[model samples]
Target: MSTAHTALIVPPRLGEPLRVVPVEGPDSLKDLLGGDFESVARGDWHLYLNAEGTTGDLPANLRAAQLMHDCGLDLAGAARGPAVILGRDAKGKDTNIPEHLLRRAEELFGTPQAA
Candidate 1:
């Protein structure tokens, strides 16, 4: 199969910035099925983002997003505003401040909240 992978950096919000990660290899398909990421129905391309990597290079979000677009990856399901759910915070926690954030993420991302 083509090694070309798909990357995504959802629009971030007040909490922190998310890493622009690309999915590939074996787990890539599983991640798409709601394994590693939460499913977002915002648009097309099956929007699913990691719950961690918010403290990543904040400035790179747009650039990475643009790269995804250039790579012919689907982004219609991407968030128009700041991102909501992340794999975890810089410290490796499931959610961030404003406890409701997790709930909102669960609601929108369509995944069960972490324990």
Candidate 2:
């Protein structure tokens, strides 16, 4: 089994600040993503999302996509709802999503913007 620090990105409501919460373990996945979950590969990272995000209340996560894009990470598809980003190590086991990337995301989207 792989152990890595996971980063959670919950798309903000209109005019709200972007949410960047750190996920501790697999147990929290259910709490954050709800009942079911799915994963998408974005560059070297795997992005996990709520399986029902499309049919549920989740909106298009433009800020997240922008954050990844700004960090020079290639996006495989559009993101929706809350998301979790995790990386794989040399042994192909889950590892921490780079600290710099998470830091950059917080610096850029952690606060609310001026109208």
Model 2 — TM-score against the truth? Answer: 0.64
What are the per-residue Cα lDDT tens digits for candidate 2 across 49-87? Answer: 778876886777776667767757554445666666666
Candidate 2 residue runs with Cα over 4 Å from true position = 1-6, 14-25, 71-77, 111-115
Alpha-carbon runs more than 4 Å astray in model 1: 11-13, 29-44, 49-115
The C-alpha TM-scores of every prediction are 0.25, 0.64
Q: After superposition, how far is residue 75 of candidate 2 from its true place, in Å?
A: 5.9
Q: Cα RMSD for candidate 1?
A: 15.1
Kindly give the stretch of ten consecutive residues in candidate 1 with the minimal lDDT sum. Answer: 93-102
Give the TM-score (vs. native) of candidate 1.
Answer: 0.25
